[model samples]
Target: MRVSMDLELKDIPGQLVLALKPVSEFKGNLISVVHHHEKKTPRGKIPVHLVFEIKPDHLDNIISLLEESGISVVSVDEKRYLEHGAVILIGHIVHTDIKDTIDKVDNTGYAEIVDLNLSMPRVNRPSSASLKIDAVSKQHMSAAIELLKSIAKEKDLLVIEPIGIN
Candidate 1:
């Protein structure tokens, strides 16, 4: 799973390394790290934002190690969406209520529209959009695409799904 964590480290030498050691010890793949050395929290601790991928079961152990090392964990967010797929939609996207279309997918709880790029060549002409969808698994991705296809049909839009989506 992908995890995002907000950590507060004491403003001292080697504190950043001390905080990240636990994550590395647990074999977590580091995705990103943002260290706010110039910015201090109200408590005077340095703030760090970390994004990494690790086994879900190892999260607690990492947290314990960080606390033991004097690192304060502010928050943690886990993203369960592990599968991604893309589709091209050609239609009157803006006119069809883009928010409603995206809401339908997100409302399912298992999937969401992560990215969208729309092109409008001329006013009142057909528009094209590329959408990136993320879900917990490939099955959920397929279901989301199928739902999008059904929505497109009702809206008189064209859904150009990626090849071999099945």
Candidate 2:
């Protein structure tokens, strides 16, 4: 399967090789690599565009390995991140690693967080967040909600699920 990946690597010697190591390690068929050195993010990292083909099953490993090596995966193919649903999570949202929470859904391959709005009353208290998650279809959206519920519970957050979804 053809997969697209956007990565940001730390600007340093050998960073490019370190960035491409994961793809080659996974035996992925390389399609292209667009290294944008002139463009730097707020953190001064360089953006990289990678396209490759690999067995569907190898995707998770490739992603995991790349992340383990400290590459920031900005985005991946959202093939199933089309159908959507919204949910609200209330609690220590920021303290609990909000990005990790969003990643939990996005990594599922069937869903991703499309948008998020957070309301914080004070700098030191819990907050409420509204999130829109897109999935492959309505059923996938439901599954995404289920996954969100599980993650939220683990983080001691309260979940206000979809109105009409059982």
Candidate 3:
């Protein structure tokens, strides 16, 4: 199976090596790597595009190891979702737990959070965030959205579902 990965790494020395070491350790054959040092991501990390080939069964193991090593696997899958959706959540995001929200979406296995933006004006003020979620099918996407809504309701937060395209 051919795998393409987009990674964000620190700019310091040894960071690239740290990212690539997992490929060999997991028995993945590296095809190519495109590191864009000239451009940095919004998070201030360098962006790297890499391609590799590995046995289908080893894919999940490799991904788990990468994440365990503190590398964020933004996206990984054979099927692409043609449909996309975005939603907004208003609450005390930090107190409510952002990692817990991400874990819920990731644990579902059918959908994943592709992007997130959070803002808070003050400790007492409500925080708002926009989440971009991707799924293999519309039904799965709706299910994920429903799960998010449930979480919001439980936390006493407001959830704005995707009503139209931005």
- The models' CA-based lDDT, in order, is 0.93, 0.86, 0.81
- Model 1 TM-score, 2 decimals: 0.56
lDDT of 2 at 102: 92
The runs of at least 3 residues in candidate 2 whose Cα sits more than 4 Å from the true structure, single-residue gaps closed, are 1-80
Inter-residue clash pairs, candidate 2: none
Per-residue alpha-carbon lDDT of model 2 for 50-107, expressed as tens digits? 9887666788888898899898999998232446788999999999999899999999
RMSD of each: 7.0, 12.4, 12.9
Task: Give Cα distance to truth, residue 48, candidate 1, Å.
Answer: 22
Candidate No. with top TM-score = 1
Among all windows of 10 consecutive residues in model 1, the one with the lowest summed lDDT is: 134-143
Question: Candidate 1's residue-wise lDDT over 57-147, tens digit each?
Answer: 8999999999998899999999888899999999999999999999999999889999999999999899999999998778889999999
TM-score per candidate, chains pooled:
0.56, 0.51, 0.52
Instruction: Show the colliding residue pairs in model 1.
Output: none
**Worst lDDT 10-window in candidate 2:** 77-86
- Lowest-sum lDDT 10-residue window in model 3: 75-84
